[model samples]
Target: MIVVGIIGRPDSPWCHDATACLVVDGRVVVALEQERLSRRRFAPGEGPEETLRLLLAEQGLRPSDVDAIGYAWADATPEIARRVDSALPCGVLGTDRLTETVFPTLAAELRNKEIFFFDHHLCHAAQTYWFNPHRDADVLVADGTGGAGSTSLFRVRDGRFELLDRYSPLWSIGIFYEAAAFYAGLGWDAAGKLMGLSSYGRPSGRRFMTFDDGAGEFRLDPALRGLPSGGFTEERLAHEWTAIFEASAFPYAAGASNTFDYATFATDVQETVEDVGMALARRLRRRSGHDALLVAGGVALNAHLNRRLALESGYRRVSSTTAPHDGGAAIGAGLLAASVLGEPVRRRDPADPLPIFLGPAVGTAAIEAALDAESVPRQALEPEKLRAQVAEALDRGEIVAWFDGPIEVGPRALGARSLLSSPRSRTTLDRLNVIKGRAAWRPAALALTGAGFDAIDIEPAVAGLTEYMLCVHRVGERDWDRVATGVHVDGTTRAQHVADGSEFGALLGAVGRVSGLPGLINTSLNLRGRPMVLTPAHAVELFAEAPEVDLLVMPPYLVRRP
Candidate 1:
């Protein structure tokens, strides 16, 4: 069966991160995010038409060739629907708009094919559970708000999902974090910045959220909730938090000179999130009697929380997908449709649990054309020589922009699209942050080979989490000096372990030969406000704009400043 899964709703304020994917039989044929092609961040208020068209064109598929279509929202159960209708404000669900507008438009474009709408949280759950190697596990989905609510727990036995517990949007950890982000003068999408700032301050023991162990429920403080309303927005929540904080013992002003107070607030929020996440994971393990845990949704993007759960959640194994946020829901929607139509869901090989480098590949001709258009001086070298030269440049404390193979599908750069720097010097980190237009406190991640994993102090069981840099692991005190650039103030590093035979792994090996460390500080190859580069032209544009980048490595061709 051929299935296509889609996300996003046109003109909907709540719908963002538009994406689409095509599944043939049981394997993913192609997946693309609208933001990558549209050159927009999150592709707000956009539809998946561009991405859907590209997915079909890549596989030489027509609208008539697809057997089923799956949408990532508006198919909740009757009970879920009722809860959403009662608890959420008008225009928040978007079910009516999807049915009356979006679905009909899609059907007309696709030759009136059968369209399947999936429960929002179910799609998130399916995206993680179906793609992972585990046969049975407890899945947790937490995001801003889904069709039913914000948080859900499910038990997956064999290939089916059973909902165990769910919470209303009133008790959302995502919203709590967003409020904190706004209060700290960071935007709603700045959760990552808030997380990084947490490392600089000690937790003050002030609680914004709490969990009930016996009931397995999380509660938001009434003070943060402000006035009781049907729904919530970041602006309203931020205002609520502001009033509460202003009346507290330490009143917070937006542009206050005291940086420590802001850091303290971030630390408190981060600790609270970790504590609630731990409680939820323990509850899921006990209720489902499962040894493995699968996490999805936006909150799963928190590497620190993921690390704590992996180490302390009482699960033998824990895993999260590279695209755990809404963009990943497209994959899950397709897999769910395939299963519903009596097709067996695809299971990845245990050895290669994540095959997420699913974007379009760049051909050598494209690279050559891009270079010629810029009239830049470049050289084409053999693979061995290219690696040697690039490794030497990195060893000399120069930064390189590495773009190879298909574009990565998620928020992370991974190995396919990255900025490379030597980890031996703290100055390298400073230079990288400047080049990428990021805050100085924002730490960079590391890409290493299997051998480099042994050099760091990390739990063996959580090795799977490191494959996509989804979890942070402690660096041994002894080896801290070796990878000083990658280690954060908290002594933890988010790392990715690449295969020995891959192009990136070969580069890391070459670097080891020169620098004695088999890793490089890896970050996305885009500026702070831009999306990762999708095509060779995009890569060349970034290289030209960021003069600080010493080398542009596009596999066989090496381009340097004239």
Candidate 2:
């Protein structure tokens, strides 16, 4: 049965359902992003016409080929939520109103296939468990709030997934980090900026607030609904977030404070997060008596936290997928739909060698057309040639925008949709951010390649699992001078270790061979305050807008001419 799982919120820009995966005959097929074909970023509200068309055409799937449709979002968000009255500062947005848009759409789409509506958090839990390696792992769900729960906890037992608890998007860990990003004066959807910033400073009671007076725990806090009526305006959120930052961690040093807070704060933040995580991990470990813990949520992006949870937490095992955020929920919704229909569940172990090539694969023709349209210089660099040239650019300190392969599913730059450059020079770092029109202080990331990580001084667990640039790595003593600009103020670097032959790997080899640096300063291919560049057109427009970007490597073609 061709079951398409979709996840698009009401009033959101595009229908995310088109990218939904269907579990068929024990194989994971069907992972599409609405934007790739439609050429929009998070195109919410719009139908998945292009996706359905492309699916049917590319896979020889007809409309009738679809047996069922599963929505990642709740049919009615309210019906699923446990009415969170009196929200916390960063709690879920409007936990009170159910997303009523699900029903009418499901009913409409059902004419072609059986439509299934799932509770939002349940979908998140499904993602947690589906990606979990352990059969009976406890589940943790985290995201920007789905009606009520921005972050939630769950447990998997006896072939079933269950929720342990729920938390609102407000006072939410996601929002807290988000607020920190904003406080650092970064752009929207730029939590990475906070991670980068956190690398520069020590957590001096400024960026953290205790849950209890001296609980040593921190939460994104704001005023709750003091009245019987429960509702808070966006203005209120902005006001409260502003207050918290003013009262707490707003550094006022014009003398150029250490840009290394990310290390200390990330370390402290990771440690503090581990404190909460360890408490929860211990509780779940004791309650379930199962060694494995499955965590899903945007917070899962905290690699430093993840390392602590995996190494220090009480759980015997920890599992999270490369795409554990909202995007992966599309996969979960499909899995759930398959399960509910009495279809046999075939689990894909996260350990079974899963590389996150989840989104639509752009055709070479499309890429060529884009290159031709831009009249950019063209040449397919053989592995060695490209490597040497790219290395030369890096050694010379050029900011190159790298877009290769299928776009990664989640909200990370990864190596697929990254910008590359020199991390060694303060001038290069400043130029890159200025090119991005982002905060001048924001640090760039490094995409390492091969097994040469030991040669570069960095904290353990960082250079190893940097396949995705999710976690912050501690820069070691020797590499500090080289990666100073790339390393956050706190001395941590978000690194993506690329395998030897992949696009990222090749790029790394090139840079390493030339400059003796494993990778370039990495960042997404997007302007500040925008989503990553999703297509050739996006790349073209972006380069046109920001002329300083020296080159764009789209494989077989490079864009350097205006």
Candidate 3:
């Protein structure tokens, strides 16, 4: 049976989601976010209408072919969550709302097909475990607000999940971090930037946050909760954090002093998250008696904490997918619907997980069409010659926009839709960030061949499982200069180990052969504040806009600025 899974639309322009997924025969055949097609950063109030239409048409099936529908969120969001002043229109839908707007005729035809509403945190857990290699493990999910609360812990034994404990939104460490992001003036999506900035400052003795080990809950200082109730908005969050900061001994700073202050705040928050998460993982590991751990949620996106947990959690194995955030919930929702319908879920081996090349594929014809439509000058070369040209361009310190195969599934580029550059240059990071219009502090990652891991200080177990750009590893002193451009201020780098024999791996190998560099500095192929480019048209348009970008590698065609 074919099951379609979807996430609720973003409430406003600055928010994210509106991801549509189609899981056919228990495998996610297609998943796309509305922002990619709409060209708006996390396009608000948009449903999956266009994404669903394209995915179905590609498979020669219509909406009527779907047997069931699954929603990533639970039946309803908490009423307090509705009080926030969302920056965009609120057309985000759940299963009930979906039945009204998506595919009128298909709704009538598939009247017997059941509509399933998976709990939000459960969806996060399912996404991690269903495709995870571990058969029995402890699953931990931490996010901002989901249904009744924030944090959830579950024990998965032989393909089933048993809830061990849960915490309400009041104890949400994720929300606390979001407030910290707002305090840094980086906004909501800047959690990553917060993590990077943390490297620049030492942990402070503010002691405003703590975790209760016995209770297994987060305890925030009462002063941090500036709002009367739990209602949170960007403005409110900023105000609340400001009050807390003002009360501190080293109050808010002005001008350049603000950067140091923000960095200190980021460092304290990072340390707090680490302290709480590690304690929780250790306790859960002992209680569940599981050797492996599967983690999800937006907070799971913290690669630094992930690397630390992999080493210290006491579990023999730890696993997390690249899309641990809400976008991945579509995968979980799809798998859950498949189980309810009795379809066989794909069981990958513990060591060999599923490949994440799940986005829409672009063909040679489509590339040519986009180039022709845009009136861009281009060169067409054979595969081997094109690889050689790209490698040579990288060696010369030119940033190349590389597009190939299906786009990656998660927030990371993962070599599918990535910007490739020489990692040896000290200034490459700054230049790339400028070209992408991102803050200088946001870190770009590296795509390394397997052999390159030997140069970095990564644990054997963690390095062996480094398919996605999820965990951070310290760059060895000897190899620091080689990948310096991609390494963050903390001497750590989030690297995606390219698998042998894949097209992307071949390109990385070629770059290594030419420049003797450990890996290529790889980042998402889009400007800052934009979702990864979807179609060749989007890539072509981006190419036209960024003159600093040297070349656009679209399979057989390569376009250089005229």
Tell me the whole-model lDDT of each prediction, alpha carbons only. Answer: 0.79, 0.61, 0.74
Winner on TM-score between 1 and 3 is 1
**Candidates sorted on lDDT, descending:** 1, 3, 2
List the candidates ranked by TM-score, beginning with the highest. Answer: 1, 3, 2
After superposition on all CA atoms, what RMSD does each candidate show versus the true structure?
4.1, 6.4, 5.2
lDDT of 1 by residue, 1-562 (tens): 8998888867576678989889899777678888888888998877787777777877888867888767787632223222222211111121222333444455555665555667788888888887788889899888877766878889988876888888877667787787677667776688888898889987778777788767976666665534324556545655665565555515356536554568888898899888888888877887898988999999998999999888888898899877888888988888877776778786766876366688866789999999889987889999999999999999999999999988888888888889999988888888899988887877778787887777566444265577778888788788888898988999888778777777788999999888887889999989878888888889899999998999999979999888
Model 2: residues >4 Å from true position, as ranges? 9-27, 32-56, 75-112, 157-159, 167-171, 179-190, 199-275, 349-353, 462-465, 559-562
TM-score of each: 0.92, 0.79, 0.90
Q: What ranges in model 1 sit over 4 Å off?
A: 75-109, 220-229, 233-235, 249-251, 255-259, 456-461
Q: Which predicted model would earn the best TM-score?
A: 1
The TM-score between candidate 2 and the true structure equals 0.79
- Residue-wise C-alpha lDDT for candidate 3, range 181-249, written one tens digit per residue: 766767765778788888998776555666675677666666553432357543454456556655552
Worst 10 residues of 1 by lDDT: 86-95
Which pairs of residues have clashing backbones in candidate 1? none
lDDT over C-alpha atoms for residue 484 of model 2: 72
Error of 2 at 173 (Å): 2.8
